[model samples]
Target: MALKSEQARVLRRRVLGGLIRNLLLFSGAFALACLAIETFMVPSIANWVADSTSSWRTLNSSEQFQQILTDQGLLDDANLFDLWVNEAVEGGYTNDAGTITEIQGEVNEMEDALAEYASMMADSPENAEAAAAHAKERAEKLGADVAVASGTNAAAIGDASTFIDDATALDAETDNARAVPLLPYQTILTAEAIPTDDASAAQAIAALRVSASLQELGLSLPEAQTFMPPETTVDAATRILVSAAVLGYDQPTLNDLLQSAFRQSQEQAYSAWLDLTSAEEARALGVSDENPVWQIQYGEDGVYRMRDVATYTFVKSFKLPLALLVFVAGWLAIILRALNRSLRYFDELSGAVGRLLADKDAPIELPADLSIARNELAVIRSQSLADERAAHAAEQRKNELVAYLAHDIRTPLTSVLGYLDLLRETTDLPRETLRKYANIAYSKAERLESLINEFFEITRYNLSAIPIERETVGVRLFCQQVAEAFFPEAAARNIRITVDAAGAGQFFIDPDKLARALGNVLRNAVAYADANSVIAIAARQDARTTTITVANRGREISDAHLETIFEKFYREDRARSSKKGGAGLGLAIAREIVVAHHGDIEAASERGVTVFTLRIPTQGEEIEGAAAAPRIPGATEGVQRPVEPVPPRTVRPASTRATSAPPSATARRGPSARPIPQRPVGERTQAPRQGTSPLNPRNARHGQVPARKTVRDNDATPRRRGLSR
Candidate 1:
């Protein structure tokens, strides 16, 4: 299927456009779900999609982390380092800002604690007082702090209905510059000297400030912790416990320290496991439990050291991409199916074209989508069928013409036979009687011969009806000769004939066939011209064609008859007898020969003048109808022809049928298409009557001894030799 044809091009473009549109639409929808619409989801579906597929990675990482720990003899039931590190690192998420702040806080606290502990260990009285004053200042600061707000949900900030008016403001942000308060003046922070024996003394010094602050709020320690500043998790808790025990801590304080130490130990072990792989090792290895492309999976190597995304990467999911592929593939299949179905309409067209000549009456049908092509095909079929019906009608008319011609031949033949028999039987007949008998017999024989010739013309009206040989001819001479050929018959009726070939110099045409065509027209005109009426023959030429017209003055042919006058076997008056009526093929055959040169003929009658016009193209083309499949033994039955109420009633159709030349003086040189009013059938045809019918012996001008004579065919075809132009 070439894309050049209309149907193929239409379907191809449509299918391609559909596919492109579908792809673009699908892509847009996918992008909307991923970029625009997904943001409104509660969990942020990206997080869901991004995190949901992490289970396998998590398991793999946990195993790999454990393997390293086990290799280092650090993996034990009590430690469970992998779990510790996973939580501490917040599901292994990088925490660049949090890590910096955590390490800073630890450093600040260690500095203060060590300074106080060193002063107490110095055992100097002033150093101890200064330390006591410092502790008193810290307690006073703690006491001035606001009490912890009460609430179960941390987001509510201690009250379920707590309004966050500032947060709603567009420019809202944290107040990073908190004011550091000065200590309030105290009358006495030291009620007595510090006790040396009690293990609670150290704790008392450290805890009393926070405890006193809590008592001021009348809240328990845990409750006060909400308002208190947050502390980072301390590492090496066991060392802190050992040092505190050596400083004389009792069972209760020791128990608290032991518990804190136990939990911190687990965290410390995790920190140690991650520390096993240094920054160097981290960059080199492609581990099993890593991000896609062996990116860092767990906390740095195995330890829980917070880092940024630029350093540590995570795993990815393929689900969304896979789903997109399936979506596009399925749509592609649907597009193919739709396009495939459209091509089936062409199949319907093929079948419909094949059935154009079938003997069926049903209309060809197609899908609504193919309406344009369908309607056009329907028109073609209608024309073909109409031509078929007309052909049949033409065939029927041919048979009728044959029967009528036979009858006509019989009339003349019987007369001739009867006249001859009378002459043969009467031995002593009078000289004048014998002369009359001979004249009658000769006339009948002539009529019979004319009828036989007409029949022969009809038989030639088929696929190979006539062949043409084109040549240049003198238009003036041609028109003059054709007009002069009818002078005899024209004179017999006192009808004058004129030729107008002005500006019609030489023209290219088929001389013989074109002459015959012109002769037929002139003959018809002469036979029907009014007595003393003028028959004018005109020939002219333009750039492309040569035009000739023969006009006679007589009774008018009705518009109805004019339409069909050029069809096969069409008679103006069928009742006209052998002597006056034609088989009706003269004008029709004239038209055929003219059309063969790629031109046309037309007739018009108005007032009392009837005219027949012929046009022949300067550049001839083949007449397609002439060489068409031979008709069913095609005879121009209306021998001669009619347009069969066909040819759109526009003069005539281009057909392959020919016409028979009946013994028609009516076909002679006549403008008579309508019948003479109430005239007898065989009466001397008047008011457009036959003049000196070459068929009727009484009407023919026979020769005297010294007179030169002219003989002509029925249609005035110039068979005369040595004829002067």
Candidate 2:
């Protein structure tokens, strides 16, 4: 019951955690979207509105009008004033400046007209004659008539309210500005005269009077000028009032006059500004000069309209909010993209971890698509991939080690079993038989021990559990000594061991390990070799490395076995361990020792010959000696050369037996690896005595031969040798 409760609690916790994670992920996504809209999208719309020319102009006008009201000391009740300003600025005073500009342009047009007249008259072809005639005429009767018309117009201006007050003040204060002279009665009456016999003269006189009055108006006055009209009509009074308001007079009916002007001007202004017709027509027309007058008349209505347009102020007001929105939204997109990448990374990581758990030794390869992932996630992915690779390499190494161990352990056991069987059945055999079986068993066991030591040595080397002891030894002496050690064993079986010295000095190496490796090779050569056959050990050195070769006579190794021959229990003959008594681990141990010394070992085999080569770094001086003498000088040559040894691992070869069978036939109980010539059973009936073959009489026997010719059949090998019964 307690365990069940615990399991349920764990399951609940997992479910809650998953729910929380999912909730957070969705919440983050929604929050990011909201931020994008609030921070960037809304502001972008506001900015677009603010940048519109009509909107911008509306905003500017409202701002200016508000300032005008403030400067006019009209902002007493702030809220009320704001409301009033909004109404007045938007609806009424919106285009006041535009109207002022138009009026100013009218004055400019008048000036331009006057200038054009002067330029045209001055540049005329008959200017001198025309000017004289016109002046004469003006100085006569026409000049008087022009003066009378000027007098009348001056009288009207004197009564006008815009000029009357100031003109009256100036006349009262300045002696030079005493009443502006009223035109004579004759000038006024001349304007009404009908054209008769002197029609041209009358028209010229009227033109002169208008020109003269305009000249007087252009003159600089002291402070004011005064005049009195002959009479004032209602139309004239209204005109006076309207004109006075345009010049900024405060009086009754002023607002009415301004309203009328505003109505007319705004109609024209809207058409031009909005391009109500085609753009070309709009360009040709403009706002009326009287727009401000009309706006002032409309009062609150116009101001409110303008103020409404200006409220875009809110859109442009806060700089930071808009920028903040954009910044937040853009960064949110980047973050979300990064999150997606992280999720992908988690997926890849999960896969890699699963592969690791399953102990897959194959490399875990990542897709190149990872380049699109976030940088940090990419790095994490890369590290995971690297870790997978490392794990795979370790796994492969472990498999190789296991295979090596199994091979090493089984080889010696097979040899031991084979020899034990031989010993049990050979109780009444010859002394040589007892000696041969005993020596072969001993050698096999020794090989097995060496293999065990090699495995330990390799483990220690990799683990750094043991330190190598380096000592100097004479190279020549070391080689000779190791060779002599194996000489007795070789002589026991009538085999010959030889050494060739290529140097004359001392060198450095782990003497013990080197000797063991060399001994294993020599012992192997002796066991597999023929009686009276020679095994040679030779050494040489170049600038970089010292080479030691062990050459031996035998059947050639197949190409398939050359690559793995140094591996533990990797025998050329599949049944070499079982039939001939070997652990098949000698070369493996030798290879390990050489590698520990930072050297290399290789094997090359050809027809009936095999060479095991070892190369190590050369020491300061090479060994000094004559060519080594053969331990057994009278030994006969075999089909192939011998393997050599170097430094402290040199050894002589033990004697071994070789025999041949007739071609095309098979037998057991002989050297499993011997390159024996075999013959068919049918053909052998006509052959000479079996015990009298020139190759070796012992090999020709039917019963058990001497130890020197002992052979054994091997598994996987057919009836290739006929030396055994």
Candidate 3:
């Protein structure tokens, strides 16, 4: 394809690609925004719900039941019940105390008899009968006391084993009194029992109390006997009746049966109370009780019912911290996922770019399976890659354009230089000599035109201009023609030029462009050669390529200049020495041409020899056998120089032929692009070697003439003055 066309495509793609990339980046940013919303918004609501559920404790089934029971009137008779209990208790206490006093008096009498017996035993050492007799009397008195206590108290002292701590601690007067369970419920039971009169009810209560005391105290038969009154012996019939009443067996009094039933009820109630209290205590202590609530039932019939209560069990749901954790966790996950995906996309992009840079020819393949492609990150990456490709292509095209310009321009310019040289050498008559000078003037003008053209070409490449044009050509003829064409200039400076070839033949190239490329190398050699120095030009071709070198003998250039010698407008001798030449565009143009042909050129200077070598690919062929045919050997030599047609008026414009001769010391120094400092005209007192300093540009302008330097005295200094333009 044409370089200009390719360059246009490259620029368009670059601009469009940039716009697309920007759009992709925007899309990626939007994806990131969505992720942010997910991370921050939804979980806050969930947390609010969780926090509000934690404060109040709910009631269980048992507690609710207890409340219902409290609303009923079953427990309202307590006051009346207490009143009845007090009256009954007073009468019982009085009767019991009277009986106890009688028993005590009898016991006291027995104690006296016992004391007397002890004294008799001590006095009657010889009379054991006296001691025995006193003891018998004490025994009879004790028996009488027990009978009396029992008969009066109206309660049987069942047996000695039945005695309790309270019964023993009481005085003899109070010992016979009835004992009842100390509880508020006792009053309720008492009041509920109907009595015709207060006294009768009191007697009934006293009997019931006596029965309760006998059973709870566990009084034995022997103990009962001691408390009995003196004349109240407990005979078989009386014993039977007492036994039946106390034990609540056969023939028991109504009060006795009620007391037994009451005792049983109290015991059952106590057991229930213990169980309920234990369960409550466990729950209070933070232990899990099977039943955490208490149930209580009160019946008008004096029945109290208790049961294990039910508990409401549930997990504490309203944890502020946990709720906050859920909210934060959910948001954090979203944020992390978003950030992670972004980072992953960046990583992939970086890798892809690295690989593309390493190998531009390879196609870009990305891993977009991570949901990144569906997101904005993918778009950004794709855009970036597209931009990169466009830039790469544009850059490539620009370089190729530079190459095409340099090669094409140099081709015509070389022919013009050669023709001017031929015209100068062949003409001798006065009019013809002056006319050819005009021709030489035209040649120099063409040279400047070529230079300007190459300059713009390079500038365009640097700014990303047109693409390259390439083709194949024979290497042998290309190298020979370029070398031979510079032969006249070499001879003018007494510099010998040689061409050596080997191996390969043809090269893939644009011939006109390549010829100009080779010309630049020769030009540099001619400008830099020392007087009588051999400027060797050699060409070699291998399976892969051909290398043509133009070398000159001169002072070597420094490493710094050698590196940048091919740069544009690089003139080695800027301060016109005695042998200055053209503007510094030769090497630069040469380098561009070589590149356009898909070749390369390099410069090296060492040991007084500066060499510029151009390497271009070639097809297989013998080297040196074929040499470039010289510009149709001079017209007089029988070398049938065909008559050339005159150029059309439009083709040969007068303005194109106007130019001044080259300056004197236009030396291509070492392998440098920058011009080297030259010896001033005043300093040229010493003779310059043959090829080192050519004729002065001023002298050449006036007439073709040369001069030899003259040295005066040892310390003589020449007067310095600027040369004429």
Candidate 4:
């Protein structure tokens, strides 16, 4: 239980440690990822925002105008005004040749009128004096009118010529301006041909006003009309003259008018270009009027240009999210690897446990990396092996017990069968001989009965604790009485028996159980004791214990055998020869009985003497009523006849009836000279009388012994014997 608890604690600690380690690792990785994003990615995006804002702030109005011109492709090296004029002519916005033709025709008409007036004056001279006065007046009026009209026409023609020359010069200037790729806003002023030399700001303003008026009038003309009505034409000419007078010439006004016309055309063209180019398309080309990154800067040439100043870096677009993705993937992989390892560990452990449970004999194997200190598998495996060994040992002991019982029972049975067979076959035998065979057979039968009873005693001892009948028994007297039962057998072997009970007192024990225990010890002593050697039985007591020592001069038991002498089925004679040794249960049974009385038994042997000591705890509490003590079959009760030892080589004279022998004969021949009586062939023996010793001379002398008639002396046996002979 303690081992299992410790293993559980170790397992918990290992699991907790793994969890903490994984958590720390994940946290550390996440922190590093965040740090990288902050350190590298953040600055890049911030710089892009700052540059974009600065780029937008740098643009001015002139730069914006140039940017629009550049986008429309109008600022190219080609002559912009010439191209405009060509486009205007194709679309019929102006008719320059028709205007020149109209002016020439007007001059011709003035000349024709002056010639007609001269002819009228010459032809009218015939009307003489009366008509002279009228003609002269009309002539003067006509001439004056012709002169005025001619002068006005000639002035208009000169103005027209001047306007044409100025336009040609203005066109040349526009062509020059268009020659440079980056023309300035001031270039447009040059294209207008406006003379700034010696011009006052006020005079320039007046010139601008007159030029704006002329441009408006030209724009209002219908393309299909080559000439205006006479009144309208006259008014237009008067205005031109008035603008020229105010500005001192028409050239400045013409320059202003041209500049205005150029601007209007440029704006219209720029609007068309804007409509075709989307903001997104403009950014793709690296020049955006909308995006702040596409900034415009003014040069010393007074020209405006666009350039890209700021560009987005890769870090701003990709690094942070990419780093985050990498971190997540790495963390997931680590987690999966840990999960796989844990799963494999559990699989191995589960498989080992399953196989072990299926077959207890199977070997337990675990993963190599499993920690021996923390794992319980090793401990469990060792315990299983120990249990298996213990089970095997128990099985071996059981087999040995069965074999020993079989051999012991057979020994007594053989003798009984031998004697009984002899009686059945012999014909005309003497009555004494028949009685002798019968007596021998009966003694052998009793021995067999005793051997069988030992088996039962062994079974009872193993099943549970034997109920002990506690009583006050005289220790000295009990030992003496038990010793007396073995005297005849000891005497038959020429072995001496002695009892010593000095300092012994009445002991609280189970009397019948103690007697049985002592009988077993005494029987063993007699069987193995050498002839003429002494067997001693002594009882001693202390304040707490009563000790009985039974010692015999016999074959010395080895030190190894002595320790196991009281174990069931252990014997000094391993061969288990029935004539020389018992079934090895006697001492074991004795030990059981002693233990049931709260006592212990031990054995020792040295110097050719073997001794068994039985110690009972006399001071312990005694049980009041115990179950009836087990009766050992064939155990002597009243007047027990001592078992006689077999001679080395001797046949009995068959007439000895030991039970019927007189007390004087028994006393003279020694106690074993007579046999105990046997029952008749069909009759059962009566219950043995209690409290009467079979060896008592009084009972034998008074004829209190149960008797049986000799079978060989009967008439029926003789008749049967005669027929057999």
Every candidate's lDDT: 0.46, 0.41, 0.42, 0.47
The residue-level lDDT of candidate 3 at 249 comes to: 35
Consecutive 10-residue window with the lowest summed lDDT within model 2: 680-689
- Per-residue lDDT, model 3, residue 437, is 61
Taking the tens digit of each residue's C-alpha lDDT, what string does model 1 give over 322-355?
6578677767776776667666766887777776
Report the Cα lDDT for candidate 1: 0.46
lDDT, candidate 2, 475-525, per-residue tens:
667667777877766777677777775553555776766666676666767
lDDT of 2: 0.41
Give the poorly placed runs of model 4, Cα more than 4 Å off. Answer: 1-429, 454-518, 536-548, 592-600, 615-725
Strongest candidate by lDDT = 4
Q: How large an RMSD does model 2 have?
A: 24.0
Give the lDDT of residue 257 in candidate 2.
40
Cα deviation at 14, candidate 4, in Å, is: 6.7
- Candidate 4 structure quality by residue, lDDT tens digits, 50-120: 46644432112333333443344433335333332343234332333233233333323333332343243
Candidate 4, lDDT over the whole model: 0.47
Best by TM-score: 1
Better of 3 and 4 by TM-score: 4
